[model samples]
Target: MASDPVTLNEFLTERLGAGGVVDDPNDLLRYITDWAGDHRGKPLLVARPRTTEEVAEIVAHCHCHGIPMVAQGGHTGLVGGAQPDAERPELVISLERLSRIREIDPLNFTISVDAGCVLQSVKDAAMEHDCDFPLSLGAQGSCQIGGNVSTNAGGLNVLRHGMMRQLVLGLEVVLPDGRVWNAMHALHKDNRGYDIKQLFIGAEGTLGIVTGAVLKLTPRAQATRTALVAVPDVAAALALYGQARRSCCDLLSAFELIPRACLELAFEAAPDLPDPFDTVYPVYVLLEVAASGSVDLDAMIEHLFEHGTTAGMVLDGVLAGSDAQAERLWQIRERMVEGQQLRGEHLRTDIALPISSLGDFFHTASRAMAARSPETMVIAYGHIGDGNLHFNLLPPADLDLAAKKTLLHDLEAALFSLVDDYHGSISAEHGIGRVKQTSFLNGLDATERELFEGIKALFDPDELMAAGRILPRTR
Candidate 1:
């Protein structure tokens, strides 16, 4: 397979005709810039396929032409994983048009959908059948299931429902050589051979393009109890989390840590959002418990608070009295992201540590950053239940954006080193996209790097399936 620009264009026009080709530079703009505006690139062409067959055809043509392929979903990825790198002139295969909900099995509690289907759409379809697809995320409204599966996305509900890997029963992927592997078995037990579908789960599209998926659904929760509690510090937050997990057991759906800074920013951005506490505490926990049937959730939460307060774990608390109050409380969490986005230059790190080490991680990270640069603000917050913290570092308001770049490398190093020390993952939910590839590779040993290279060669020998991703070049 070799690339000849003129020859390939002619072949594309003859094969795909006018159906799914987008070569216009202006039209290709959306595919170039990443969702976070951190990375930008120019994709030689944008392929918008309407079906699995069309996607296969595109991949086959790209394979034969030695034209590297980049699979893009809703382009809502925070990392630059969806966007092509500046080094390569790759073809962007957007799965937006391949969006089609194939089937919904209420009895089996499974839903089959095309990879291009919006995550929220799939969740809505599951709800239509009286089931729940619990992979909830900030970008669910636009991000595709294919992207979610590719990155093995871990959303806010990872504490309860787990990641995309748990929800996904099977996947339909097109290999680098353009062969479709339809492993769409919706059965509970199938140890027939190698669990090959997993190879593409978190490969970051380095292995192949996921075209379709059969996802397992859960029984819909009929009742929920939501509470916003204040903790004196991270240690108290962890104590509250332990109590909630023990009391609620499997019913514990979410336990989120919200720093005072995050809440302050939210209040500044959205004044309509009601403050849960009269006096802002240093730390806050957004906790929720859900069950499939009606139960006295209020009493359970109230009872927990009664004892928790006595133990000095809960400094202050506010239970959502009504549905409107519940939604308003959730709004505070949702607005956290918006507030960060609107604020000055910041670096958002998605790292997960051992649940017990979360407080230490935050304390150490804040101290390290402040020692290195006191003007830097560390707005630490995330799912304490799952130990995934979006430990965001905000630059001084007076610091120039360009000047902040010079300080990023050192700050990121200190933070990642701290994470590694805690036996935590540098990337908890967000996959290691191009932006993190160098650091990701540097963290691996020769043995691990060798295995990564071997697998990359096996699935993508030509180095054409999103090469230089996860594994850097010069391997």
Candidate 2:
């Protein structure tokens, strides 16, 4: 049987030390919520473990007593994957204290770090050795490597470097039984049987607790080009992307789509942010290309501009002249989320579809939004190159909280129905934490659910890890 709150608290304090155990409501407040402020939980206690051995001990104790637990790092996840269950007496195992750079193999082009190491710190460490870790995100400064790996994060650089799954070569995870599995090998080729490490990469901490990782790195970009090109519509943007890929090839780092509405909100949110052009076009494509060695990136970007203009895909554009100028152009993309926040209650859906289906989806979704809520504004944008769209809805701002939520819920159903029609994922880069659990499961086939459940049973038979997270707790 699971121990009582008092027993669990004493045991945690004994194992993790009094300083490591946070039962005080004030401190627990920080661990209870997520970065998006969308989900909150009531964890019995937050346990801060300083080492892998300490994590194992805590897990073993939990396993023995049938106590549920959730592994956390930075708590910057959009989905409620890391937050403890409000109903369960779950322990929040925060890995922040395990922050460390175990090794950096410059020649091998890899960096192994503790799960608690912040994403920006890992990037900085790689840069110190003249290497680059390309998993770039808006929350990189606060998000941890473990959480990024767990969610299989795809950020601005995903078009160039791929997601966290591609960058992570190996991992060190603490299983539910409290046994440590050290597969943290920085190997480029491991043709051995089934890749065991792949299981935990995007598992959302449902299967086990990730403690360390060996991540792949690339050479720092030596030459770069950035431009914000105004396109007539999604088709024009698509043509521009194709031209960019053919012209710049592997150097194409980011290709983001920003609608005029999103930009307007961005302007409202950050007035100091300069406009890229005088004429406000219908849509904008923020294109960035980088190379490690000698290559005429300037000519490549110039050719893209020339071709886009000739093809009538480019309406108006601005090519960044300097690093500062490039950063300024990128700021428009970065401030988009803040713009959504400024707009009040909004439904954010991270869905991915085939590149060709984007235009159809856009038009169809617009019609759907109009039919459902005529006053609701659709402010959509995302990494167009990867077919991921952050389809968002800003309903009538004057509605009260309850009314707003009801409208959002209805709008979400309408949009997701479109997502279903287009045969796209409801959750792309972001894992289906607590937010999309119902829809995610409803969409899954019986066989798929069975397989998932069997796998969960194999790794976490007790279902004590991350209760009611990706899947509901059987108990």
Best by lDDT: 2
Clashing pairs in 1: none
lDDT of 1 at 17: 71
Worst 10 residues of 2 by lDDT: 1-10
| lDDT (tens digit, per residue) of candidate 1 on 199-245 | 89988999999999999999888887788999888898898888888
Top TM-score: which candidate number? 2
TM-score of each: 0.96, 0.98
Which runs in model 1 stand beyond 4 Å of their true positions? 1-19
Q: After superposition, how far is residue 105 of candidate 2 from its true place, in Å?
A: 0.7
How displaced is residue 413 in candidate 1, in Å?
A: 0.4
lDDT of 2 by residue, 1-475 (tens): 5467788888878887888899889889899987778888988788999999999999999999988899999898888889888888689999999999999999999999999999999999999998999999889999999899889999998888999989999899999999999999999999999998998988999989999999999998888889999999988998888888888867999999999998888788889999988887999999899898999988888888888999999988899999999998888888878989877678888999988899889889989899988999998899989999999998897889899899999989888888988899898899888999988998899999999999999999889898688887778
